[model samples]
Target chain A: MRTVEFETIAEAVADAAIDAGRVLPEDVLAALAAAHDRETAPIAKEILERVIENARIAREHQMPLCQDCGLAVCFVRIGSEVRVAGGGIADAINEGVRRGYERGYLRKSVLNDPLKRMNTDDNTPAVIHFDIVGADELTIGYMAKGGGCENMSRTAMLTPADGRDGVIEFVVKTVRKAGGNPCPPIIVGVGIGGTLERAALLAKRTLLRRLDEHNDDADLAALEAEILDRVNALGIGPQGMGGNTTALGVHVEAFPCHIASLPVAVNIECHSHRTRRIVL
Target chain B: MTDTHILTTPLTDEHVAELRAGDRVLLSGVVYTARDAAHRRMIECLERDEPLPIPIDGQVIYYVGPTPAPPGRVIGSAGPTTSYRMDPYTQRLLALGLKATIGKGRRSQQVVEAMKRHRAVYLAAIGGAAALIASSIKECKVLAYEDLGPEAVRRLVVENFPAIVANDIYGGSVYEETTECSD
Candidate 1:
C-alpha cells in the first residue's frame, strides 16, 4: 500500500483552492468565447466580453475572480491500496481550505450554522465527498461553488413514465424560473436516476466535467444537446437582461435506479466556474 | 442601444428622471454597501423607529459583500451579489428616499413597482466581474456593523463604475425589453 502524508494533501488542497478561485477552467473560458461570438444582443455581447476580461484580470493579478469566493467543495477518490498518514483526510482538506482562503485573500463565506448565521471566518470545513476505488492512486477534485447558483439548484422525483421529455421540460422550467438570480450564461448540470441524494450529488459531479466533453453514452449526449437548445431558448440571456445565450452548456449524468424511482436533480453553475484536480 | 450616461451620487431627482431601461451608466462618487444581514438590521432599526447608520436620502446602496483587502490594496474583487434576496427589505428603503440600488440580476415585481412609485431606478453590475469592478473602487471604509464581517455597511468611493439601468421609474424593464426568444 502507498502512503500519502497529510501535510502533502493539505498543501495540495490549499494550492488547488487558491488556483480554483482565480482561474476559470480553460474549457469554460473557451465556451464563453464561443458564446461571445454567437451572442447577437448588444448588451449580451458586451457582458460576455466583460466576463472574459474579468477572468484575465483575476489570473494576471492573482486575485480571487469574484468577491463571493464561495464555499469549498472536494470530491475525492481514494484507492483501496492507498492510506493517508498523519491525520484524517477530511481534516487535512479543511486545513488546506482555511489556509488557502486566508493566504489567497479569498472571501470566507461559510456560516457556522444555517439558522444562527455566524460567519465561520476561515471557510471550513469543506463539503467533501469520497469514493473508494480499486487503484493505488488518490485523486482529489475541487470546486469553489458560489452561493447564488447553489441556491438555485433543485431536485425532483419523476415517475418512470415521464421519460426524456419530462426531464427536458423540468430543466427548462427551472432555468426560466431562475432568471438572472443564479447569474445566467449559466452552466446547467443535470443528474438523472439514482436516489434523491445521489441524484443531487450526481448533478454536482457532472459540473466537474469539462464543457467540451461529451457523455460516454450516446443517448445521454443527445439528451444533453436537446436540453441545451431548450434552455438557451429561455431568453434569460446574460444576467437575465435577455438574449439567446442564457446558458453556456448543459451537462447530464445518469445512473440506474429501482423500477419505481426516477429521481432528477439540477445544479446550476455560474459562468465563473472554478475547478481543479490533482492526483497522487 | 442608448447613449451611455455618466452619473454621480448623491443622485438628484432629475438624474433619476432621465434614466431609461437599457441605458449604460458609468456611476462615480460615494455609494454605501449592504447585503442580507445588514439589510435585516436596517429594517429592524426602521421598525423600531431608530435612525439608520447611513442616511438614505438621495443615496445609492450597492449590494456587495467584498473580500477583505490583501496588503497594499484598498479592496479585493468587489462585485455585485444577487439582488432578489434583498427584495423583502428594498421597498421600505426606497420609501425612505433611497435613489438607486446597484446589484446583479432581476428585482422582484414589487420592488420594481416600488421603484416606480418612489421615482428611483435599479442598476445591474455585471455579476462575477469582481476583479475588474475592484479597479473602479478608489476607497472603502466600514460605516457600521463591523461584526457582520463582509456583510457590514461600508462607504465606497468609485470612479466610472459600470452598470446598466435594469428598471426605471417609467416602468421600463431591460429584462422585458431585450427578450427575443419565445416562451
Candidate 2:
C-alpha cells in the first residue's frame, strides 16, 4: 500500500478550504458572465455585474467571497491500495478545517450542537463523505456551502405516476416558493431515483459538477435543460429582483432504487458557488 | 425607472416617504448589525421589558454577521444575510421605531404590513457581494453581544453602500413588481 502522510492530507485540506472560500470556480464565473450577457432587465444586469465584481475582489485580495464562509464539506475518494499514516482521516480533515478557518479568516459557522447552538469557533468537524475506489490515488472535493440556499433544499418521495412532468413541476414550484430567498440566479442540483437520504446526497454531489458540463447521459442532459428552462421562466431572476435568468444551471443525478421508491431531492446553490477538487 | 438617491442614517419621515420599490440607494452613515442570534437576544430583552443594547429609533439595522477581519482591515467580507429568518421579530423591532432594515431576499407579508404601518422600508444589498460590500464600510465596532462572535451586534459606518429598496411604506414591493412584469 502506498502511504500518504497525515500532515500532507491535512495541509492539502487546509489549502482547499481557504482557496474555496476566496475563489469562485471558473465555471461559475463564466456562467455569471453569460448570465449578464443574456439578462434583459437593467436591474438584473446591474446585479450580475456586482456579482462578477465581487468574485474579482474576493480573489484579488484573498478575502472570503461572502460574509458566510459556509460549512466546510469535503468529499473524499480513497483507493484500497492507499493508506494514511499518523492519524485518522477524519481527524486530519477536522484539523485542516480548524486551521483553514482561522488562518484564512473565513467565518467559523459550525455549531457544536444543533439545539444548544454554540459556535465551535474553529469551524471544525467538516462534513466528510468517503468513497473507496480502485485506483491508487486519492481524490478530494470540497465545497463551502452557505446556509441561505441550503435552507431551501428539498426532498420528496414521489409516486411513480408523478414521472418526469411531476419532477419538473416540483422543482419549478420549489424555486418559485423559494423566490428571492435562495439568492438567485441559483444553480439547481436534482437527485432522482435514489432512496430519500441517498437522493439528497446525490443532489448535493451534482452541485460539484462544473456548470459548463452536462450529464453524459443524453436523457438526463435533456431533463436538466427542461428544468433550467422552466425554472428561469419563473422569473425569480437575479436576487429575485425579477428577470429572465432565475437559474444558471440545473444538473440531475439518478441512481437505481427499490421498486417501491421514487425519491427526488433538489439542492439549491447560490451565485457565490465556491468549490474545489484536489488529487493526491 | 427611478433615480438613485444618496441617503444618510437617522432617516427622517420625509426620507422614508419618498422611497419606492426598485429605487437605487447609496446609503452612508451609521447602521447597526444583527443576525439570528442577536435578534433572538434582542427579543428576549424586549420580553423582559429591558431596553435594547442599542437605541432603535430612526436607525437602520443590517441583517449581517460578518467574518472576522483580516489584519489591517476594518471588517472582513461583510454582506447581507437572508432576511426571512428574522421575520418573527421584525415587526416588533419596527414597532420600536426602527426606520429601515437592510438584507437580502424577501420578507414575509406580515413584515411588509408592519413596514407599511410603521412607515419603514426594506432594502437589499447584493446577496453574495460580500467583498464589494466591505469596501463601502469604512469602520466597524462591536457594540454589544461580543460573546456571539460573528453574530455580535456591531456599529458600522459606511459610505455609498449600494442597495435597492425592495419594499416600501406604501405597500410597493420590488419583488412583486418584477414578478408581475415577468409574467
Off by over 4 Å in 2: B177-183
> TM-scores for all candidates?
0.98, 0.98
Candidate 2 backbone collisions, by pair:
none
Which residue runs does candidate 1 get wrong by more than 4 Å?
A: B177-183
For model 2, what share of native contacts is present?
A: 0.77
lDDT score, residue A41, model 1? 88
Two-chain DockQ for each candidate model: 0.62, 0.61
Q: How much is B57 displaced in model 2, in angstroms?
A: 0.7
**Across residues A125-238, which tens digit of lDDT does each residue of candidate 1 receive?**
899999999978799989999999999888999999999888898888788878888888999999999899999999999999999998999999999999999988878899
Q: How close to the true structure is residue A135 of candidate 1, measured as C-alpha lDDT?
A: 77
Residue A215, candidate 1: how far off, in angstroms?
0.5
**TM-score, chain B, each candidate:** 0.95, 0.96
lDDT of 2 by residue, A1-280 (tens): 8898889888988999899999998889899999999998999999999999999999999999999999988889999999999998889888888888999999999898999999989987789999999868798888889999999888889988888998998888778888888889999999999789899999999999999899999999999999999988887899999889999999999999888878999999998898889777
Classified by CAPRI criteria, candidate 1 counts as medium
- Residue B11, model 1: lDDT of 95
